[model samples]
Target: MGHGWRTLRRKILTPNVSATYLETRGFRRKDRESQELLEKVGALFLAGYAHAVEASSIADVEARLGTIEHRFRGFAYEGAGMGYGMLDGLPFGHRHHNDDFLAGPAADQIYIVYCGIGWAMARLPRFRWPKAESLDPLLRWLVLDGYGFHQAYFHTRRYVHEHYQAPRFPWPDDESRAYANRAIDQGIGRALWFVGCTDVAEVARLVRTYPAARHGDLWAGVGLASTYACGASRDELVRLTELAGEHRPQLAQGSAFAAEARVKAGLWIPETDSATKILCGQDAETAARISVEMRPEHVRNGALPSYELWRQRIAEELMSLGGVSK
Candidate 1:
């Protein structure tokens, strides 16, 4: 497809647009089965907290989260799969395996999990939602992908490009909003998760966040989140990759290559390479092309690899002779 046609195709077929026009504004259009499922998950956490939400101990909350993860797994390839939901969810009925979950149910898991985190932090009476500080370093580390998803869910959308560069601080509420503003709900949600864990140092925090709960999905989220939002130094990401190799080589590979992809696409800061410096033209087209080109080499017809084999090879090609410390 030509670039112009691709642009239109994206506007029509992109996942976020489906969620926006179909789910958020018109969720009630088809009786909101998907939204209701999300609410059920939220209510599970709310009830788990004895209705006090964030009042529960970390262990208690995590135990409930275990139950919630089952729902997410249902959306994964391992489970029954997302099946594009019963309503106007993102279409992947034709997708074979986990990509269906990646494109579809993953978003649902994120929004619902983000809500659960907020609920766990919130108290009644005043009903104030703190900045999620109550979640200790470990718990905060746990939701890195959901946090990244919360943001990428919006930033990756066609609407943000049609509207503006990205959302600014002092973000407007949905009642008074544009595509960028509303779409950034994903990022804003992730920011809260990030802030909750920021009290710890970047590398340590990312490492702590790498417990093998959701396996590759969680690691992939970390890879993208660190690249797009963590604002860590290049050296730090290298160290992060090394550390991830210890836990799961794929985790390391995912972060390493994801960082490379984002840098090439202008979505990330430049590292040591001068080539990347020029790549940072902030040209959206370049980013889009990089995204298209980033199909994990050798995967025919765009079958994304597991976190282990995904982008690490590309990262190897991009790395300089004197790269991060061993």
Candidate 2:
């Protein structure tokens, strides 16, 4: 059913990979570029990931990642889109990372790199259970949520896990993490519709029930699933965004932000842009616009995914922005 629905979604929602199709979703495409540069970087990462995963040692994976860390060091994958990308460069490992790959010594600030690794660690596991398992789930949550997404991403391998020892945040009125976390996970691709289909007030009330730090992630997930997966109408998108923004503007902005980048790149399946746009908002738009020029000439580039190339493009764009740091 999941596989079949995925197919139907592409046909119905993505029907085409052009600006016209995107316009239906309120994504006004402002650009295009050669697929060349995107492929080269993708190839490099794929090679890196393939080798990293094959190794028996976590040390080997980090060693392989060390060679390519510089490429994405500045790529923005934080906030609502935290850990959505970088799965290709960071395979799971048994022990915590060996900080040598980073430009400087590791600190909590260096969580960006760990966040990238953690994202790959979390999202990629659904592909083959226990196959690439390395990083501890709690630790992965720690690094990914080092900024505060654990509210939504926390879970046990078979069910949700509890953290009795971690610092605690007050829950909203009477809401509990158990109720919210399970709902968000179950709502993965359908929460937005579920709120209306089920009970808007209950869902909205639930969103407001959690502490701000964690609830933002739940709201962000709702915003993303509601906006992108449901093929929401412009009015619906606006309403959903408004609802999510009320609790978490960063999460509400995700779908549009991702949609804008994917539309510009002509990608039906986006990468970090899916959620990064939620947190970065207009900053994502500006970076995506600049990414077009980053595309190499078709004749010169080969075998890479255009979406990955956009990160390099945005990295360059952000450098020019002068005030913001991802």
Residue 30 CA error for candidate 1 (Å)? 42
Candidate 2 residue pairs that clash: 38-304, 39-303, 39-304, 156-159, 156-161, 172-209, 253-278, 254-278
lDDT of each: 0.31, 0.34
Per-residue lDDT tens digits for candidate 2, residues 85-145, read 3323334423232333232322322433443454343444334212212432222222333
| TM-scores for every candidate against the unseen true structure | 0.29, 0.31
Per-residue C-alpha lDDT of model 1 across residues 58-78, encoded as one tens digit per residue = 343335334544422211211
Quote the positional error of residue 237 for candidate 2 in Å: 2.5
Which regions of candidate 1 fall more than 4 Å away from where they truly are?
Answer: 1-87, 90-220, 233-252, 255-308, 315-326
RMSD of 2: 16.4
Q: Which ten residues in a row are the worst by lDDT in model 1?
A: 78-87
Which candidate's TM-score is highest? Answer: 2
Global fold similarity of model 2 (TM-score):
0.31
